[model samples]
Target chain A: GDKVKQSPSALSLQEGTNSALRCNFSIAATTVQWFLQNPRGSLINLFYLVPGTKENGRLKSAFDSKESYSTLHIRDAQLEDSGTYFCAAPQGGSAKLIFGEGTKLTVSS
Target chain B: EAAVTQSPRNKVAVTGGKVTLSCNQTNNHNNMYWYRQDTGHGLRLIHYSYGAGSTEKGDIPDGYKASRPSQENFSLILELATPSQTSVYFCASGDAGGNGQLYFGEGSKLTVL
Candidate 1:
């Protein structure tokens, strides 16, 4: 079984539209992080959450440890956002991290 | 600015050959990690380190080994590369407190033939 599961394995949204990505954790995760893997294969850290919500520009992320899930919301999508979005959480009692399969987001013009 | 760099952005190896992937971090973070990404799968942790002179095995450490010689350097070793080992390897560094924020490198693509 997967320690973390991401919803909507693939997504396509139009420009200026809003969309949300999600991750559900089966383990007792204390922290959750969101990353954006660009077309060039570089991972850009978007948010690191303990249990609350965070917002950066048009991107907002929320992590609910009690519910064992996290959500990433993107507003006004752009072509530059066309890539893969991943959510990760650390293993219980260890520094090791577990990641979701990732949601491939493609924003069309 | 925090930065993590990976060497030999791309590599090709023969079956049963030796392969070494290196990572360097300028963030001065105490924790560093190695992960592999393959199509259809999430990023799988291969190995990690707490700090200098410390290394720990991640979930998938069966065919791989790791070393952290210094605070700024970490390396992943593949003693006997196989075709199944082909994947993109990423190196990341961050604080040891489980802050959830990890600085990642550009990733190294390895092909085993």
Candidate 2:
């Protein structure tokens, strides 16, 4: 059973458009972290949330523990932003994280 | 900022042979973890450690073994390698409470033939 599940398995966007990715958790997740695996296959940390919202550049993320879900919003998408996005949360009280399947995003000019 | 490095960026192993992937982190964080990345599966936890000299089994630890000799070094051992073991392995370091976002290495690609 997957503790975290991501929606829209894949996405395509035009340059300068905005898109949002979502993750639903089946477990009691206290915290959430978002990561982006770029075209080069490097997973870069995006945002770490605890029931609130955080914005960085063109990216914004929010987590709601009570709702058991999280969202990563990408604004003004660029070609370089094309990649897979993953949202992760810990299972119960452990330090180990359970990850979602990931959303493959492609932004074309 | 945390620094996590992985050795042998790429490796190839013959079936039934032994393979060891090494990782070192200089963040001084007490929590470290190893995960594997596959096409459909985002990332699966293989092993983790709270501190030096301690290794804990993760969700998928049956075919893999882990060793944490010190705070800076952690190794994942694949004894009797199999083709199914081929994947990209990642090493990460984070705070003990696990609230901090994990700092990751570039990743190590291992191919088992």
Could you give candidate 2's per-residue lDDT for residues A7-34 as a string of tens digits? 9899999999999999999999999999
TM-score: which candidate is best? 2
Expressed as tens digits, the lDDT of each residue in B1-113 for candidate 1 is 57999988999999999999999999789999999999987799999999999999888998999999999999999999999999999999988876547889999999999
Write out the backbone clash pairs for model 2. Answer: none
TM-score of chain A of 2: 0.97
Question: Model 2 scores what on Cα lDDT?
Answer: 0.92
> What C-alpha lDDT, on a 0 to 100 scale, does residue A79 get in candidate 2?
94
lDDT of 2 by residue, B17-97 (tens): 999999999989898999999888889999999889989999999899999999999999998899999999999988897
For candidate 2 chain B, the 10 contiguous residues with the lowest summed lDDT are B94-103
Instruction: Judge candidate 1 against the unseen true structure and give its global Cα lDDT, from 0 to 1.
Output: 0.93
Angstrom error of the Cα, residue B23, model 1: value is 0.7
